[model samples]
Target: MDPTHSTLLHRLLDATTWRAFDVDAEGRILAGHDASGSVQLVELRPDGARVPLTALPGAVSGRYVPGSRRVVVSHDAGGNERAQLSLLDPDAVTAPLGEDELTPLVRDPDHIHGLVEVLPTGEVVYTTNRRNGVDFDLVVHRLADGTETVLYDGGGMVGGATVSHEGTRALMTRPGRPALSSQVLLLVGDTTTELTDAGEHARYGGLEWLPGGETAIVTSDSGRDHLGVAALDVATGHLTWLVTDDAHDVTARLSPDGRRLLVVTDDDGASRLAIHDADGTFLRDVALPAELRAGVADFLTLPRWSPDGTGLAITWTDPATPADVLLVDAERGRAGVVASSREPLADLDLVDPTSHGVPTPDGETVPCFVYAPPEPSGSSVVIVHGGPEGQSVRSFSAVVQALVGDGHTVLVPNVRGSVGYGKRWYSLDDVERRLDSVADLAALHTHLPRLGLDPARSALWGGSYGGYMVLAGLAFQPQLWAAGVDIVGISSLVTFLENTSPYRRAHREREYGSLERDREFLERASPLNRIGDVRAPLFVIHGANDPRVPLSEAEQVAAAVRANGVEVEMVVYDDEGHGLAKRANRLDAYPRAVAFLGRALA
Candidate 1:
């Protein structure tokens, strides 16, 4: 590797970013800072002092206990994704958390027990699969008596649980028919009722109760193409659409007072934040910084309101800046960065991607973000995002920046199966139509020349489902891609469904087609079945403890391709599961992959 490229990759991989997840009444922010090399929960005090909270091996996520000074910390062993819940007292700890300091709330490694809500009455409402490995049940653990009550055991997956303000009722979300659509089940005293019709094809989530808990605000696309914020009546499953948009999906966050609402619109992967009254009357649009976007997806980051509702704390990011917490004055509609991690690369100029829509063979347009370097290198990379349901948003990425810095044009596309486009677009590649997404890669390659890139020197790169796309692209269209990089990808859908975690199988099968019903189709869709056609040199990365896509997937495909006398490089991290979360591992793995791509493309 060139000395300058090596230094650039090292610096980009080592750059630390801070994210604020929750804030308290005292203005203390519970933030995720990777200054310790791994993301750990740190208390950002109002006095500008940062106090380390938990120092675990895996990345930690946390939220402050409602109406209490104590915090609930959630972490997993390595990258297994079976997150365990623990509690910590930030006021009592002056240093990083010791082994015994974290009070075990739910500590079982065999199954997942996720924290839903910590009520003021010392009851923790969580979902766990302790009853059986496949199904998740909502249970309320009372800290006062050490007793537990199963709130809703109506089978399938308890996607989410939220307790009412009075603690007399709860709402649990269950997976709908297509898995993308979710149905809400309301629990009042001992009776449970479905808030959403079982026959509907809509998705409902982001449920927040108003003052008395009689009516709650939720984001739903029940009878529409795009998601919009609506108010749902608890007594009857009546929905009153609040913020409806013909073009984009909008999510709403109610203020602490329940008087104001902060609504965010997903305008083609970017965020547009606005404030609305309780009745959905438009107040004013928040004047955000140019190109600085707020949370587009709930999991990416959420805009949190202060306990008093006077200020808002949002995780904002642009192409050059990492996710940072910005405290906004709700009354004035102005914001400033309260916690940031942009100092490390302050002087370095990073590449910014321009959004474009590549036309597919069927006249459908695939949205893509292209990162072109200032000088042409004749080589380009097509990076696919994992979540067949996930979108490639305009967020900060060190890998894209490093690749562009090394003179490689990168194209990030949201194919047919990607979310944020609409229900029709996402469902296009489901089950039997799986290979249609793989075809999008060839379309992207054909359009590379329009962007001043040589189609013959292009490569494929992705992780998880994206990794599957990479393998599929190289295998299905061998002559298009020069080389390919797959990280934690699925090689065989048949083996993937067979070996993936039990709890995930049924849910994933809804999208990929079940093993019992569609075994032959899965075998046909698997990249391993067509591995003999893969002429490009390949690099595979995987995690040994991956529960979703087992290590066998990577091993089988690499071995099969190598048998054909093709060059193959494989790297497996014992400490990782789905993807590389540790900085040290990323610094080690990404540099080699980039070098391989450089040589292969050359």
Candidate 2:
């Protein structure tokens, strides 16, 4: 790696962000911090003291039990994302909780579990796929005797599960088979009722049960292009719209007293918060502090209501700032930073991206964020985001900043199948339509030269699905890119579906199509099939334990390209999965990526 690029990578990796997941009765915040290079649970004290709670190898997320001192943290091994729930003692002043100190609430090696809520009775409610690895079932685990009881087992993916304040009722959301649509189920005692029939092409999520237990609030896109918050009756399946907007409106949380509602709207990729009364009346928009408003805060930690219901604990971030936990007053809308994960950049100039839409050949506009250095390098790198279902929002990205610092323009595009753009746009790249998104990338490359970027010097880069896009671009449009980098991306949709973890296979097949029926289409869409067409130098990175894409995705493509006489480099991380999580591995992998692109683009 070049000395300058190495320094740039160090500066980018040094910045750490903590996400405030939940607050305890004592006002201690449970947050996920990556200060140790791997994400772990931390107790953020009101007095400004930081205490490490869990030292997991991958990402960790948890919440504080309202009435107890114990916290529940969920983490997956490596990056397989089969989350396991564990109990933590916040007062122990422990170095990450050891294997012995941590008590597993739901421990099934072959199954995945997620923490839903911890009741006052010390009973934990979570969703698991133990019954059938493909579907999630809501279960209640009694902490007193360690008894597990299944609450509900609807035959589909359970997105989330939430219990009402009094614990008499619960609400669960299951996305439809296609996933662009969803339905909410209400659980009362032994009976269950469907709350909303969002129909086809509509999606509903962000479930928040009201204190009354009879009514709940949720975000729905039914009969509208944008998402809106609606109050639903648990018994009658009736819904009353509380807030509606042309943009996507999401229900973040309802106050403890159930009087104030924290609502966030997706304005393109930026977030705007609106407050509402319990009776479905809009109060006012919470004024985002200038710092938060300046950059992309699309994924703000779902704003949590304070114990007193007068304020909210939120995680805010942008391109120039790492995430910070802030307490914002509900009445005044004033925000104060409670915990910060900002790191000094050592005088390195960071670029703030400009969001715009690029016109594709089919007359569709693709959203994108561009970060350009001050001096014209005439070279550019297109960074594609994973989740053909995900969007590229404005957020702080060390890789983008580092690449821009190295005098190359960076473009982050939210292609066709991305969310936040309504259901129709989101399904545009599904299954056989996948390569349409690749065409969007080619269109983006064509527009770069107009922005003073030299097409011949430009490279394509991405991870996971984005990584798939990189390979697709190089193969489908061989002359367009000078080089390509793939990180845990799929080279062959057919092989990926066959090799991916069984639990996630169905869900992925929904997006990429199943091998049973669409085998030919999948093969034609795969970049591996077109390896002979790729003319650019290619670099591939993968984690040995990745359950989603699997390590073979990288090996197969790298081998095929090498056989075709194309310059190819492969780097595999044994300790990581899905994506690189540990700080040390990232430090090792990313610098090499920068150096590879630097040499190829130069």
Candidate 3:
């Protein structure tokens, strides 16, 4: 009777992750992201084309500097946080800002990415750390003279920095200790003031400055039990809840114009998008096609907004198909599919156009996505998507698209541990079955080579748990792959659950078994304990401030992987966790990845 997720799944199909829209000062039809996540920028002109100034892996957290002639995207280059400040005129290619002038800086293994905002006076203001159980500070730098000063430390957990339209003030959210709760803070020229004290651990998200810095729209969960949109008076530090809810929770996002608020919410298991006036009056429920809402048990969960303000983009899923991006219009009430997301049965190396899906270790057939260039037999990079619980669907992938455009076949697999299939299929790699996922990946070397994928030129790639799979495949089946990459993967699961973030603290018990309760099972699941058998080229990337796996997880593996004379390459972003957020970091990671793949896969 229930083909679609009738619960939380439907609500979250839209905002399964975070996204930011880069509208011009006029908020016109600029180039926006369908699946690029929150990583782009656009320079709007009154007469000419609204140029999208967004650098790939661009500045998701950078502020605009007046008359600077360009925007700064921050990330990590090698070991230091590097800024890719691209000029907007022709394209977003410009010189990169190094750490010569910025100091007291840290590139912790967990938190490694930084955000930049160039001031009219040639000062670059940026957030300097991660929300990884530590407070963050906003520091400013003078380019001409090379002077640095702390704007406001804000206790270390500050995020989402927004400058006033007039460029005099800034708005940011600060998280308190214990992790779940936070408050809003406003920074004046020389003074740091607390903005709102909603409650203990009240989650505040995405603070947007209004026409000027006089006011801001801050999203907060009323009490973790309620969702509301509120406006704050920067002068008085007063917050007036505009949109309040007690029934089903919602997250508020201010539109580009600041006149209307976009609210993402869910009721029961169905997801719905609601538009409301700034004063809290309901506008309209953006409509979704029946088919789009099929298995989307969490609708309010997936948050997406069209650049034109006409519709919301969300992940529409059903039992028959994995969730994919679908455009939904609130005015027209129509939903249309945009992309395909089915995992293939074989290694999909573009070199061999006819390559199909491959058989798994268990004899079950599953789909595989390929990453390679136009040449039928050039270098190859097989990227196994993370989430041993995830799938390699035809969804919007930023990295894959760019790589494919650059002439490389990137293979993405929806292994057995992945969802989109029924629960039984998703539960395949839990506990003792963990190695099954590894086996599925190892088989690719044998299977892909037969299908024309030059195994000698194939490299293993993935992040998080997928990163672990990369290490395992290389260690257990060295001859099967040319090289491997591990991005914050769990080389060891025995301590993963104990040291992991509270949000995911208990997640491993059911998947990998409890260390205290099932030591043997946990030991078998970890590749770190058995690293001596590994012999392959390995490159690892990790966020220093990562709260999930912690930087130590990667360091432990890196230390061992390097000591074994396996030729180890490592990149760590001091201020990032999980994924690369700042523009500088993404750009840094991309080129390094390209080089790493070239050296190994070549």
Candidate 2 clashing pairs, residues 3+ apart or interchain: 296-394
For each candidate, the alpha-carbon lDDT, in order, equals: 0.86, 0.81, 0.57
Candidate 2: tens digits of C-alpha lDDT, residues 515-589: 999899999999999999998999899999898899999999999999989899889988788888888887888
lDDT for each residue of candidate 3 in 158-249, tens digit (9 for 90 to 100): 45676665556777776543233466777778887876673554556667776655777776663435556777788886778877666655
All candidates' TM-scores?
Answer: 0.97, 0.95, 0.50
* Deviating ranges (above 4 Å) for candidate 2: 197-199, 288-293, 296-300
Query: What's the residue-level lDDT of 28 in candidate 3?
Result: 29
Error of 2 at 572 (Å): 1.1
Ranking by lDDT: 1, 2, 3
CA shift of 197, model 3, Å: 37
Summarize candidate 1's per-residue lDDT along 208-284 as a digit string, tens digits.
88888889988888888888999999889899999989888788888877888888888777877788898999988
lDDT of 1 at 287: 82
TM-score of 1: 0.97
Q: For residue 153, what is the lDDT in candidate 2?
A: 85
Candidate 1 displacement at residue 118 in angstroms: 2.3
**On a 0 to 100 scale, what is the lDDT of residue 356 in model 1?**
97
